[model samples]
Every structure is written in structure tokens, then in C-alpha cells.
Target: RSIHVDSPPSVPSLTTSYVHGTSSVSLLYQTVGQRLDSTVQRWPEREAVVCVQDGIRRTFSQFQQDVDKAAAGLLALGLRPGDRLGVWGPNMYEWILFQFATAKAGIILVSLNTAYQANEVEFALKKVQNATDVAFKSHSLTSLTQS
Candidate 1:
């Protein structure tokens, strides 16, 4: 009885490799925030953002600064990392930015559907501590309802 053994196939070597720069999540976030803030400061007169509503355009740069300030305000409100905050409202630019802001602050952002009923809102808020509801579209702080 004769048994024959076959040679294994040869594998090709990897000649090229991709290397990513050291961009830590925290560092990247700080860099982006600093860049945006610096640009806004440098071109204070220029429009940084525009809000198009009802065919009307509202210029912004100072507005952006204010948002960062407000987000920081939340950080100052004893809301530390992992703390969950709620933003209940229609889909708007502020809501999007709030998510960014929450990430920057390392806080958890729990968005609430504007169409949610009282029970839904209650359930959402009850699950987390330090939950603050922000009504940014209202333009007035009086509209803010927190639990």
C-alpha cells in the first residue's frame, strides 16, 4: 500500500499596509471643538450656520457659540459622564447638535419623540437619573420642562 501526501499551497505576503494617525476619541473631539470655536471667533461677522424656516433665513455664528455655551451649561449642571439627559422635540438642528454636545461632554443623550404621550415621556425619563428636558425650539428657557 502506497500513500501520497500533497504539498500545501503558498500564500502571498502583504506588501502594503495602511496606517492611521493617532487620533484619540477625546483628543479628536477637543480638536474639532477647538477648531470650530476658533473659526467662529476668527470670522465672527461671517455666517457660521443658517436656520431656514418658513422661507426665512437666520444668520448664525454667535448662535453656535451660544449652543456650545448651553451644552457646557448642562455639564455645569452636575451632569457628569454617563449621566443621561433627554431632549424631547421635533427633528431640528439643535437636537443634532445636542447629540454632538453630549458626546463632547461624555454624557448620555436620550432623545424623546415629540409625538410621545405623557406615559411615554414618563417612562423615558424614569429610566435615567439626572434627566433634563430641553425645549430648544421654543427659544425661551421657560419652555424647558425637566424632571
Candidate 2:
């Protein structure tokens, strides 16, 4: 299948160097949840995630279960598909779970850097708020931040 556009851009890009591959392979249009489900079906017992700091490990099946639960929780909190959810945390197993959870929940995940100060986070939240409707009615970042 061709991935090229039917028509080129009306405006000319004088410095752009666009290239399309001539390979016979077609792209797999699937979400992260779909791919995870496929992997679990193929290799349920295979190791999917491991956090060195916490010594946390999980197989594909376990990972899928946790991600599904988190996704459900997000939905329960009134976050629907296309809703924006901002996640602020450091690199941890929980963060990975939310990464997959957001994708599975069909909510856009706005990853806030762990190093971001309170002011920066406020600015980011405001910035995204201006562009899209961010859901924070029930799912607050209070627990994730320093008290």
C-alpha cells in the first residue's frame, strides 16, 4: 500500500528534502494496546518490563492486566477517548503502566518532566489547557508531587 499523499503541498518547501521509501512493506496501523494484546497472546509469559531501582518485573500477561485496570480507572474517572491527561512523574514502573494505560484509554498523555518545578508544571498545564480540554476533576497530580 502507498503511504504517499494524493497531492503535494500547495506551498513550496525550497529547503525540504522529502523522501519516500520504495520498499514493499506496508505499515502496521495499530495502537499500543493492540500491539500489547498481540504480544501477550504470542508470549504471555515473556518478560515485558523490569525496573532496576525497584526490582519490579512483569510478564506480558501481567503487564496487560495492570494496564487494562489503569485504563479502566481512567475511564471511571470520567476521562473519555480524546481527552487530555497530564502525567507528571519520574521514570518508574508506575510511569510505564500509565504510559500504556493512557494509550489504551484513548486519552492523550501529556508527559510532564519529573524535573519540572511547580511553576513550570503550572505553565505546561495552562499551555495545554489553552489548546485542549484537560480532565483533572478527579485525577489530581497532588499525590504525585511533593507536599
lDDT by residue (17-125, candidate 1, tens digit) is 4333332233334544566666667776676545554222223465455556656877878888778888876655566567656766777788888888999888878
Model 1: runs farther than 4 Å from truth? 1-48, 54-64, 128-130, 140-147
What's the lDDT for residue 42 in model 2? 100
Query: Candidate 2 overall Cα lDDT vs. reference?
Result: 0.75
Q: RMSDs, each prediction?
A: 13.9, 7.6
Tens-place lDDT per residue, model 2, 1-147, is 346555545555566556444435556699999999999999999999988886778999989888888788778778888888887666777778888988998988888887888899889888777223232233232232212
> If scored against the real structure, what TM-score would every candidate get?
0.52, 0.72
Q: Which candidate number maximizes TM-score?
A: 2
Which residues of candidate 2, in runs, are more than 4 Å off?
A: 1-25, 130-147
Q: What count of clashes does model 2 give? A: 0
Worst 10 residues of 1 by lDDT: 138-147
Error of 2 at 52 (Å): 1.4
Pairs of colliding residues, candidate 2? none
